[model samples]
Target: MSEPIPTGCEGVDELLGGGFERGVVTQLYGPPAAGKTNLALSAAVETAARGDSALFIDTEGISVDRLEQLASARTEDVEDLASRIIVSDVLDFDEQGEAVQDAEEFAEQVELIVLDSATGFYRIRRTEDEEAGDALRTVAQQVTHLLSLARKHDLAVVITNQVFTDPDSDRARPLGGHTLTHWSGVVLRLERFRGGNRRATLEKHQAKPAGETIQFKITGEGLQSVEDVP
Candidate 1:
């Protein structure tokens, strides 16, 4: 079997049956300040430590400073790791679609691809456009194209998404509707936990059982497992 991509958290890796598997889309959805981006960055740090490249398609203006800080804790040659990460910043729906589609070309070269807050652009478009179905469909198509790239190149695809509370259950739901939930192979839901830690729940997965949760915290070094906590 191929080696699974680590998220830099042993507890999370165990919950995920040895981290994320390649050739599938992994959705990390949560509310604001849930450390979703931190998890993605931690994964990138692990990839860089392995001497591999990863692509970051940023829709929410990701912080390279934070990335450098995290990477520095893992390796002394932070510049070498930072150089391997290629970031593409997209400001609008059209540009976001283009950036996602562009991942196909770099699929073979990079071991991981992250679209931090992929639904942010779509959410904005929906609010502004009166007839939003057409725009949403276009974005959906772009996501499908990226999934194809993941399978074709056997790369780990990590996509972050926003969440809204369901009125009925009072639980958080990923805002992309069925268009996202149905397409993702693994869906991990994150929420704030006690003691400044974050809880990651296995909402959906192919191999792992659902409803399992793990604790992690965003430390100066990156996402440190709860076991490492003092």
Candidate 2:
């Protein structure tokens, strides 16, 4: 088995028994302000730092300032590290799906593939109940493509997602549901907690039992794990 990609976040890595697994799709889902994107960026840095290029499909714009802050610990030349990540800015859901589907053309060149917020445009176009199911089907199909692409190339795939909340019960869950979750071998959910800390829950995994969690804060440098978090 290939070694897991160590996300610089200390505690969370320990929780996963090393880091994110390669040759499979891992889903990171969370509500707004839960730091799902922060964790995704951290993975890109870790994966790209391994001496190979990475592909970052940016549905939401990435912050170079944040990259500089996060990459500073690993290399003096943040620009060099940043350069290793080939970013594709996708404006709409159709464009997003195309970017993910077409990634196979360059699969051999990258070690890590990240789609930050796979559901950004998905939610926008599917706001009404009638269109949500079709949107979900499209997302699920695209994720399956990513799953096959990851295994075919032995790449570590990370896709961030937003949650859908039901007004009746005030319950929130990952938007794509079982259809999307099935494709990911590992699923981690981020939840906002008190005092600027985020809780990362291991919802599904191959080795580690589910429901184990860790708390961390987004620092100037990157994510810092907390102790005795509430």
Clash list (residue pairs), candidate 2: none
- Give the alpha carbon lDDT tens digit for every residue of 1-230 in model 2: 67877887989898877887888889999998899878888878877676678788999988878877888877888888888888888988889989998889879988788888788888887775558888888888888888888898888889998888878778888887787788889999999998878999999999999999999999888889999543
lDDT of 2: 0.85
Per-model TM against the reference: 0.94, 0.94
Q: Give lDDT tens digits, candidate 1, residues 98-147.
A: 88878888888998999897788777877886556876677668767778
Please list the C-alpha lDDT of all candidates, in the order they appear.
Answer: 0.85, 0.85
Q: Which ten-residue region of model 1 has the weakest summed lDDT?
A: 221-230
Identify the runs in model 1 with alpha carbons over 4 angstroms from their true place: 227-230
lDDT of 1: 0.85
Deviation (Å) of 59 in candidate 1? 0.8
Q: Looking at candidate 1, what is the lDDT of residue 37?
A: 91
